[model samples]
Target: MTAETHGDRQLAVRLGELLGPRHPVAAAAVVTPEGTHVASRGTDADADADFDFEIGSVSKAVTGLLYADALTRGEITTDTRLGELLPLGDAPVARVTLRALSTHRSGLPRLPKSAQPWRRTITLWRNGTNPYGETLAQLLLQTRDVPLGTPRSRYSNLGYELLGHALARAATTTYSELVQQRIATPLELDCFYVPVTADELRPTALHGRSRRGRPRQPWTGEGLGPAGGIRASITSMARFTAAILDGSAPGTAALDPVAPVGGGARIGAAWITVQVKGRPITWHNGGTGGFRSWLGLDRNTGTGAVLLSATAASVDRQGFALLAEHSLSTGNSDSNSNSNSNSNSNSNSNRR
Candidate 1:
């Protein structure tokens, strides 16, 4: 119903065209300074607004929110090191600053090499195994062996995981609790951390599918939730992004670019920044065993978009394209409206 009205069908058509038939089930939304619009595909008779899928690394942005909130409260500074927050022993990562972790510059690898990541990848592809079963404690144990490189833009899931854990420790709570209380509650979002399987998300979790549309294992596990554990609907994300652009969200400081990510792209806390049509856009994307998601915003125009899909194929190019188009549209509409107002006023003066 909501998807059937309010430009939902039009947005859904655009999404469908971008994804084609590969990602049959998805939801996309655009939020402007004016209001929010939502659309969904393959959600026919069995889903509600709360229905959603894993948001993957977009969870990094959530972690970034927690970090920013703490920063504002003087709980932690950008310069705070991991060792000061958690009892990380002598791991090289212990010396890394919170800022570095947030920006993927802590020199940590994408994951602990000892985890046999390649094996896990093969198993996941062949049989849909939940490869991230290692708990936080175990993951910590493996971190000592991770060679810390010079701070640069290396995408590290392990870095965010550690950062989330350390931030939780700083707040005297678990990562899941920290996210719920600090970010979700403050923002009034219905999002859930879903440490493992969430019964609520089950009724609507678009059955995880592979690139070929074969059923794949849903990405649910402990420990990795901090790194990629958030589950939410398009509406939920749309509202959240809207909050960030409107200045009501607590963690938007995370969007402040800290270092160059690559080739003219800069990285904020967990968000990646790039110029789209001459306007700066900060965004992040995620993929699990069976889900793909993206969130982006054009702060210059207070416009944002979120795209979530049940299939593992990426929608990065499409997501960026859509956000760019909307960002440009918002600018053009403002200029055109102003021109029209002036034209009408001049016409009225002549008639008078």
Candidate 2:
């Protein structure tokens, strides 16, 4: 292996040191711009590591792809009002557009307000986080307080839920169907699925450990389906992120260049722009009840990795940051070897 290879290995080692030891990781895949296999970990043994796990908010990136494809087909514009797309009532819902929803500038809260009752009950029981239906409905009913067009960087599940609903109306298809048709199908991401069950979920699946110290499986049911319900493999995500960086996805040709968000951190559609040691990196991560996953890409190099685990502890930032930094510093791409390692570092504090 070259120096780059060693660097990637070191990064993997560091991640394992931080996140491993009985942490169930189903699959981990890394890829290069040239489509090289690179490094990896976990089981390539078919059923062992190939099982699917919920990718959570990484659903946003998938949703972004759907909207981009719609925009290209002239089906809708980013500035298209949400009200026009969905029957969001006569309450100035048009003030919120697809663009704001994609970039998370919609000023909506994380979940909808109507979810307070169920959420409170869930929290009390230490169950999973409820989906966005009730919360989104509540917020919609009280839009006056949260006005439109105000750019706030709140991570809004409500925004994505709206996007999902709008996309369904605009495309005349459900959110799950649209994601399959627009993103997964084109990319040949066969392992990706939505609204999966615990049995449908892989045993290597990760569980959610709340900030308040509660452990639960993150399933919000079909009502919250579009917001945080997606499961995919590391190999598939690596290819997906690689396509995003390389401009290979169908609608990428018309995409506005990813703009920097915080400092060198840029966001295009749904991908996060990260600058590690001055190297331009674009990536995204997902965490459901127990499963956590990370997708990192060096846009400049068009190389990246998909790290997925069955444990929340497996997908922390320290593990991913070390992997990214190692990928950059050593110039190696050992993404084929599967296994796992991670530490919950502040590397991606912005999104988490």
The model with the greatest lDDT is 1
Per-candidate alpha-carbon RMSD to the true structure: 10.3, 6.5
lDDT of 1 at 91: 76
Instruction: For candidate 1, write residues 1-352 as lDDT tens digits.
Output: 2233223667878877777777777888899877788888776554454567788878888888788888898889889999898777787878999988988888898888898888888888788766786677788888877879988778788888889888888888888789778767777777555555444355556576777776766666556777787788777788788889998988778898888866677777787777654567788788887888888888988899888888888777778777766776887743221110000010110000
> How do all models score by TM-score?
0.89, 0.75
Tell me the spans in candidate 2 whose CA falls farther than 4 Å from its real position: 1-18, 34-49, 117-125, 128-149, 196-215, 218-220, 253-260, 314-319, 322-352
Sliding window of 10 residues with minimal summed lDDT for model 1: 343-352
Q: Rate the local accuracy (lDDT) of all candidates.
A: 0.75, 0.58
Best by TM-score: 1
Q: lDDT per residue, candidate 2, 181-244, as tens digits? A: 8778888886776653445555544455543445655564443445567777655676676667
* Per-model tally of clashing residue pairs: 0, 39
